[model samples]
Target: MNRSSFIRRLSLVAAAGFASLFATSAALAQAAPPAAMRETMAIGDEPGRVSTEEVIIREGAFARQLVFFRSTEPVGTLVIHTSERFLYLVLGNNRALRYGIGVGREGFTWSGLVRVSRKAEWPDWTPPPEMIERQPYLPRFMAGGPGNPMGSRALYLGSTIYRIHGTNQPETIGHAVSSGCFRLANGDVIDLYSRVQTGTKVVIRHAATL
Candidate 1:
């Protein structure tokens, strides 16, 4: 074959090979699992980016479970044991639905009896004055979403700046890292939110009290 003719044939073959590769990639992508099914958990700092830490928290000991609990509090009450990093919803008959939680760090920890004054789903977040003062780099206001630190739900505690809320950082569960709020994995918080309502009694027990 002449040089021009041979070059034209080679070019056609190269184009066809590239097209085939693209087609195969598209097909594989279509066959792959959905992102939601594949990614079970995400971190607050990087939303939708799954990591080993996220998987360990979501499927490890931190996952929510029903457990035998001894509490004088009536059924439907919320009990938080900050030292153990667990929150229990009194279910009567000496039982409770327990969720792993992230409590306040060091000086931020407190114990008190409070009530759920209100609730919100995917609530907007405004860093409290104190929080902003401590971490001046934080946003003044952040709209709620997957990327938002507030996560999926929030149960406001009485009139205090504290709340039992969801965190995008599932790995934070079973740790002490919050400013003062009690945080749960997004799924766990959503479950808790559905089972409680405004006016629900919340008893917070710190390490000293527990």
Candidate 2:
């Protein structure tokens, strides 16, 4: 081939090689799990270990994940969909850290906007009077520890009795079992606690239909 034609062919070969390399890299990235997914949990000498622990309790879409989510809510806002049994922490870039949550039973479910009024690590548990009336066996007060149903951390929502807190019972993560709040595994709550702050906006959607 002439010099120019030979150079042109070489250029085509170089372009093809570059494209193949790019494609391979993209495929590898798509196949690999996120850094946290490669592991189980993030721990510490005490609670409040981190802000993004991946505890895969069951095999389904409700398992916690950081995924693309488009919404008008600002980053750092929290959106809870009770019917779907999921809570999403908005992370901007059309993405969110979605967590499987145990919401309230039918009669106990609620919906509205609330703010993170406070947060606690290994929080104490004091079953409200109303709760005790429903379950008289429950203790009126329990100090913070492993046995506390509030788990490793508690993010108090507004002035309401409800709180987004950790749970000793990880299996309850995706059920409508609570009186009316969000609950995550202890490890996951620590992770979430590390991410959120007081005054963070929390929006709860009661239903998904007309």
Candidate 3:
């Protein structure tokens, strides 16, 4: 083959190869599960499987931090403001450790005084019958782990099914997305689990009460 013809043929081959690689990458991206579905691997549930990037909370407002807060609740009290999507652990003297949270959506939101009835690390998840009725596709039971919708820890609230637990879906923080549970980032929830004990008071309030 002539030198110029050979060069032209090589260039075409390279272009075709590049195009194929690009197409493959795009297809893989499309095939990958969305952020919401990563954690469950189950159908019709919360977000995607957990990953380092997905686990790191990127929203500034949702990041856990100490903040100035005025409340009559005791130092150890957990005050959850559903409207603001914040769970505050009272630190006394007008300050508290605030955590971004995901609360129950519209019809699922509730408010009242309750206590921490129990705590568990990597707690197993059992979809309540009511929850199953609503989302029939959900698994009846799921073992806790990184991929579990319940993330790293759980503080059972009162005798109710509600809990303040860690969530695999960090993006859900600062949003109303649960059945009635209050969810924090795994790290934040672990910190919270360490600070509180069983029988600790939890005050849940809506925006109107605030």
Candidates' lDDT values, in order? 0.66, 0.65, 0.68
lDDT of 1 by residue, 76-191 (tens): 99998876788899999999988888764421344678899999988888866755654567788888766666778899988887788876655556655524368887777888
**Model 1: pairs clashing at backbone N, Cα or C within 3 Å:** none
- Candidate 1 versus truth, CA RMSD in Å, comes to 17.7
lDDT of 2 by residue, 1-210 (tens): 153245335544654565456545422233433221222111111222222233334345656798888989999999987667788999998999998776643213456888999999988987656566645676688888775667778999888876898866554555554233577777777878999999999998765432
Weakest 10 consecutive residues of candidate 2 by summed lDDT: 36-45
Selected candidate, larger TM-score, 1 vs 3:
3
Tell me how far the alpha carbon of residue 78 in candidate 1 is from the true structure, in angstroms, after superposition.
0.5
RMSD of each predicted structure: 17.7, 19.1, 13.9
Residue pairs in steric clash, candidate 3? 35-48, 36-47, 36-48, 37-47, 37-48, 38-47, 38-48, 38-49, 39-48, 39-49
lDDT of 3 at 75: 86
Candidate 1 lDDT for residue 206: 64
* Over 4 Å off, model 2: 1-59, 106-108, 134-137, 178-180, 208-210
| lDDT tens readout by residue for model 3, 46-101 | 43344422243433777778899999988899998876778899999999988888
Using lDDT as the yardstick, the better of models 2 and 3 is 3
lDDT minimum window of 10 residues, candidate 3: 35-44
TM-score of each: 0.68, 0.67, 0.70
Error of 1 at 53 (Å): 15
